[model samples]
Target: MDKSTEEKIYEAARKVFILKGMEGARMQEIADEAGMNKALLHYYFRNKENLFKAVFKDIFTKFFAKLKDTLLSSATTREKLTVFIDNYIDLITANPYVPSFIINEINRDPKVLSSLMFENFMEPAKVLKLFFNEVESANKSVVDPRHILTSLMGMLVFPFVARPILQMVLFQDDKVAYNNFLEERKEVVKNMMFKLIEI
Candidate 1:
């Protein structure tokens, strides 16, 4: 198939997957969204699972590529944590549906997370080691770096994952209000991290 046609199908599939999720999304719907026939979509992807896997991998890459770069960089731990928080807030805010979609699919099929993890080759342990080294160099009070990392991740991601309820309860179902709240969280999360690390 031509590159343009493939891109059209990819984008369409991404939309359908994000909106309807893996089990709910239909091949015909994706074809309609792509302005192509179902046969053409199948020609490129072979099946819905294949198409979903491609879309899932693409979303996962977009979400984590910046994180990997920031964590692996030579910046100080404080600086790395700050940058990571900022990047994470920006990424999740821009693609709010991504977290929920991935979480929901992982819940439906436990293997989804494992497959994505293997495909991404993300060694979170190394990132945690960087955190541990930072704390040791600073001679801070001893603590499990895993807890710190999990706390940081949970703080950053929870709002996006719980957006629907938050929007209703906190923002009166106003999208603009909810978005402003997220924008505020960028600084809030950074400050919280700084406080946690005593930077």
Candidate 2:
């Protein structure tokens, strides 16, 4: 129950939950990962559900914090687009399991998804609304910001989420090629968004 011990437990739990997902992760795995005893792990979290929820909440918090800073700041539209694409790509690439983890958990208990939306936790939709408003005012262009945002995120995220299939079909299991493609996406996504939105 010291701070360092508590931090260790949380960090271990996060890795386990993200890797195995909520239903698949076992408390023993988390305990082993933390180099702690089951009793002590229970002392901190009391149950697997509680521990998973804590880790999931932390993940959501970190995600929202990054997104809010990117979307809400007073950067120019181009700057914001670059920031959004860069931050989103970096986050998904680094935490390759996160998008699927969230989707799986929410699928199991849809109420959790609703709760996140109701609580306005890093509300991507709200951010899109603001960006759309700006785009309309700036150019009166016909582009839908929501569509653009979805396309950008899908382009950035789909490959990582479907890496196994893409590897077999597209890259012939060439990780080097996949990585190079992802790196190129950093610029490709930015250019695609700018072209779609710029006046």
Candidate 3:
């Protein structure tokens, strides 16, 4: 099957970035990997940083609307949590690069994620407030909103972030088995977090 120009560029960019790291990667290399010229790559993405952000945002924009809606809705913490875990894990499994892309950007520049989340993704305050509001609501299992927020996020994202090590150590580098573990994690995480928060 043929790939679109943007898809080709994204795939090429991801490969180059992985091999050389973002700072060391060059657009010419990505263009070469994509079987295109530098000018054509520039036509789609003006610069390396732009290309990088475009790649990540392409995935984020697809899911941000649903995430925003669930976070902002007046649903109980349990209800919102179920939706969040389901959608989030679905996203991670579908795009395994999503978590690493985010973590790499954060590592590249600490403030980058803050900028991405606050300015690009959604206002940080509203997300933070979602947790606090949950505590105030009749379902009061979420007293430590900040802790819950960080813990839930860590729980959801850690396995993917640590996939290489976990896959090697826990599953003897069995890719399919490791993936099954992650898939099973959806229900496991939900049940464990619910138990923790008593929500």
Candidate 4:
């Protein structure tokens, strides 16, 4: 029961923090969002900063865990990459501000991110091995895993972070259309990536 209640508070706090950021989020707003009392929220988290840290760490931890699982799975490279992109897009859509939120947090305090996450959240060796194996099997020496990873991040994240500009300039502020565009990007990104790595 306590664990479940904590999750509820985390979910509510995540939404509030992502929506309004750390400085703007209020305890009552989080309580209201969680359908709990302000005192109960404090009982669980003590204050907004603590709650923010917990939520920030919790969400990213789970997010990267999913990605790592996909990497470590027995699935084919294409399958792994597809699932990886799908999960990443899903998280970005749900928590749109995460990329920017992370950037701002890191800029604010460089040590904050390292302290928040587990030591082994991402293992560079496993990740590089997976991508390199794919490249070697395809016999494509020219295809760079580094490029794919960097490009994938930009393609997936740029749309969400630049939402206001893109939605206004190209989308004309059409919410549904812009969202549909993002949803469609899952496959579009997959196909584009497939072209690079798939034999």
Best candidate per lDDT, number? 1
- Encode model 4's per-residue lDDT on 58-177: one tens digit a residue: 766766666676666746777777787898899888768887776666687776678854564447446757666775576365656667678878998899888999999988999999
- Name the lDDT value of residue 55 in candidate 4: 81
**TM-scores across all candidates?**
0.88, 0.88, 0.76, 0.79
RMSD of 4: 3.0
lDDT of each: 0.82, 0.79, 0.75, 0.78
Clashes of each: 0, 0, 0, 0
Runs in model 2 lying further than 4 Å from the true structure: 1-3, 122-126, 138-141
Model 4: residues with Cα > 4 Å off, grouped in runs: 1-7, 117-125, 136-144
lDDT, candidate 1, at 97: 85
Q: Which prediction has more favorable lDDT, 3 or 4?
A: 4
lDDT of model 3 at residue 187?
A: 94
Q: How many collisions between residues are there in candidate 1?
A: 0
Residue pairs in collision within model 2: none
lDDT of 1 by residue, 96-157 (tens): 78889988987898876777776565475566576678855653555566677788889988
Tell me, what's the RMSD of every candidate?
2.3, 2.4, 3.5, 3.0
